[model samples]
Target: MSNSLTVGVVQQPAWPDKARSLAASEAGIRAAVSQGAQLVLLQELHATHYFCQYEDPALFDLAEPLDGPTGQRLAELAKELNIVLVGSLFEKRAAGLYHNTAVVYDRAKGRVGQYRKMHIPDDPAFYEKFYFTPGDADDERGQGFTPIDTSVGRLGVLVCWDQWYPEAARLMALSGAELLLYPTAIGWDPNDDDAEKARQKDAWTIIQRSHGVANGLPVLVANRVGFEPDHSGVGGGIAFWGGSFVCGPQGEMLAHAGEETQQLVVNIDMARSENTRRIWPYLRDRRIDAYGDLTRRYRD
Candidate 1:
């Protein structure tokens, strides 16, 4: 594997229309490729507005098979651009079955692999548990921490909430992932206090950076920006704080987006991971034999 790779993260406001969203994403990918980005990542569920704000059976129509139109389009895009593309989608596996999945396409190898989000959060405005089935033993065979082999290297791709779990990062590293990529859609309740919002965003960034340092690999996060209305006509909606960023193996920020509006194309040296791991030796020093409690729900 080479030491360096140029990556691009798209941060833009989403609209309720799917057609417009696809067009915008396509344009963004083209622009990134033109700028020499070998790998491009998009926000979570980028094909439509954040739809989990409310639980309605009608919204289930939005889900489609992984090999459906959206996947086909992205596959074509990867081929046309000749670049690896990472995209997240609301997948329709079967009738009344769905999942929040991320697909990775290696331009050279074609549709390389995929990962279904393991953690399903069910917060007030975020009703994801209603739409997605938690990824378990069934999905892990074809979709798990197993990295996607690409011309660039093995890619450790995880969805939004999965970023908070150290186990997920560790598994990916053990599976030979050269870098960690997160496709996220996170923000604040519009009614949240300014101080709370600042704290929340900081905590989010810090946790992911910690993953980079702990696993001895670079971390790339792509998040959506702008505000989307609550379909339930709730008092307020989500204001996506677009602080997408790329961090080095040692948790140093290589590039960051602004809270309001920002898009970045950053170059990362994949070789730094080896050097950082040599110095920190977190992985080499881990006592895997003493972590039996991790399997139990609680140690009590």
Candidate 2:
């Protein structure tokens, strides 16, 4: 078998209406599949605006059951297109419990695995903590990082805030993930100056790229684009810097979408990761025995 995979990302602006948003994603996926993409990823919470800007309880209405309408529609699409699909959504685990979860569907297996976001941010105009409950029932907090096995590849999937943490990526790599995937909804504060905005966006991209380099695995990010006004009047709404991209194992960007609403399809050479790891061998030189302090909250 050829050790290569074609992946696609749908970087779309959110619509208030769920049906409309689904349709937009559908169109993007279809376009990418037409281009021979075997696996596709949609941005974080593609069915709605970055609603965490306002923390009203009313927004909980957006949360849906794991097998709800969104999953049903995605399953149909995956089977029809013969593609593996990964999508992030507001998961209504129960009446009083909720999570920001990423659901994965194999073309032949339907719903395979789901990763509940481990990190929840509570920044200005990004009140994610008010909404999301962290994953991983094993710990006091944090859903343990584990890669999902898929027909396309083993995916080390993480959500937006989780992408910033190197530990998360390392754990996924150590767990046998072939690639790292992040479903992100990141952007700049309109109040920040141009330089600050540029810095923030650059840092985000660099951090994700480092994961691919450090782990010797390909990386994919699907981010939302366009700006949405803050209805709650916290401050100027976020202008989502939609630089969705894919990178090779050596931290080289294979392809990227600009700061606009567009669907991206990129061909990835999986064989390159094995060759790069053979030469770099970072994992082989690991000092795994001496890293006891990594488990601590902080060393005093």
Best by lDDT: 2
For candidate 2, write residues 38-59 as lDDT tens digits. Answer: 9999999998888899889999
Q: Model 1, residue 281: what's the lDDT?
A: 95
Q: Supply every candidate's count of residue pairs whose N, Cα or C atoms clash at under 3 angstroms.
A: 1, 2
Q: Lowest-scoring 10 consecutive residues by lDDT in candidate 2?
A: 135-144
Please give the RMSD of candidate 1 to the true structure. 1.4
The models' CA-based lDDT, in order, is: 0.87, 0.90
Residue ranges of candidate 1 with Cα displaced over 4 Å: 138-141
> Which regions of candidate 2 are displaced past 4 Å?
137-143
Candidate 1 local lDDT, residue 132 = 95
TM-score of 2: 0.96
